[model samples]
Target: MAGTSQARDGRMALSFILEKNGAPLTGTSGSLAIGEMGFIISKASSTSAFGDIPVGCFFIASASTTLKDGDSIQKVKPYFLGFATSKSLSQSKNVVDVTMDYDAATNNVSDGVVSSSGSISGSAITETLNMESGINILQSRFTSIISIDGSTIEYKEAQTTEKDILMLGWNFRDCKVGEFLDIDIVPALFSNLSKDASYGSSQTFNVDYTGNFSDENNFVGGHYIVKNVEGLLPSIARPQAAS
Candidate 1:
């Protein structure tokens, strides 16, 4: 058999493939194509086609690169670095819950509007949210990016309202950051909304959401949960000088 050789140089395109239930789900190939928003220059398997793997597991693969024979490769994993915190993902389980930076205060700064009754109406084809000022403010910022029909409606989590939702972009990610990580946002739904209304205080609601991905993009990372998070290691790097 002829000796197989690969030459690697310049910038290499990296992708993370997802395996579900010890099998490869169709359509999840490229990182951004599948909504997996992170990358790292590491090689875990010789075959680009990863074998059967389970959920909650991550792997690094190189799609396009020139690797010469006898090249020494380092073991690296693609990850996202948060602004002020770091969680050991090795301990993370499937269906991990992440708290995003968007809050009532942030919404207020951005001038979002929220309604008291909170109503979400319109067919699944076209939906709207007539929220109280706070949520309205937050949703307004993402409306351009998350709306399916470009209409506005709102609903209280406590109130039993009819909701016909297809995919909602409840979170916001920067284009620059998304380009750097090569990931995108899948359709999302805001669930479990709760708020604290005091006698003389601003009502702050907790916005919990769920994310979905098709076969194209399947991996989820920190970038999906935080803002302006990019560069696997440098995204979280801090000063090392004496304090």
Candidate 2:
């Protein structure tokens, strides 16, 4: 793995991939439209015909094509989150002080401390959007939907059901023409949404989301660098318009 010498910008493209019962969708092949978000089902082995191409990862289709099993493309439509004005991810762990009575007497010795391993605390991803797309995103997680007439929709105060979603992000500065890096947050839960508006400023919504480890998936989610040989990832162009 190589490192970039230049400082990268914070610009990123964000989207969501749906999951059922805490697992990725079954892989399939078809005419994947350009800029479609999808993931790899299986890697193209050396004995296969498309051995040079990479698989077993997520990608954004660069062009429309209808191919056989050799062409690794599993069309999994993602819920594209509108352009984000600002975004941030945070994670922390619980720490305990291990200092004892004997250690207090020693002036040269530093305080002992230990952190709980294999777990993360306060893990969250906060994003600010200036569009109304956040309303649909938040409503998808709600279990109870009370619709009044044809235009009004109300959600109950107590939401006992949880909808697990997968978040995918792509950084423009970190990706190349034939390769790109992905930031994934699997088994994520929507926390809250707050609207901010003023007399002269545009209205924006602050979306708070959290992710945790899933015993079934065995991992929370992290950054991944993938090879996009068949133009399976987007670079400069924006994703398809949100429906």
Number of clashes recorded per candidate: 36, 1
Model 1 per-residue lDDT tens digits across residues 195-231: 4567775544343333433222333232232222344
Candidate 2 local lDDT, 114-182, one digit each (tens):
221111112123332322333354544553334454564444343434644455564533356565555
Clashes of 2: 1
Which runs of model 2 end up more than 4 angstroms from their true locations? 1-3, 17-75, 99-135, 142-160, 172-174, 215-220, 234-237, 240-243
Which is the leading candidate under TM-score? 2
**So what's the TM-score on candidate 2?**
0.52
By summed lDDT, the worst window of 10 consecutive residues in model 1 runs over: 81-90
Candidate topping lDDT: 2
Give residue 51's error in model 1 in angstroms.
10
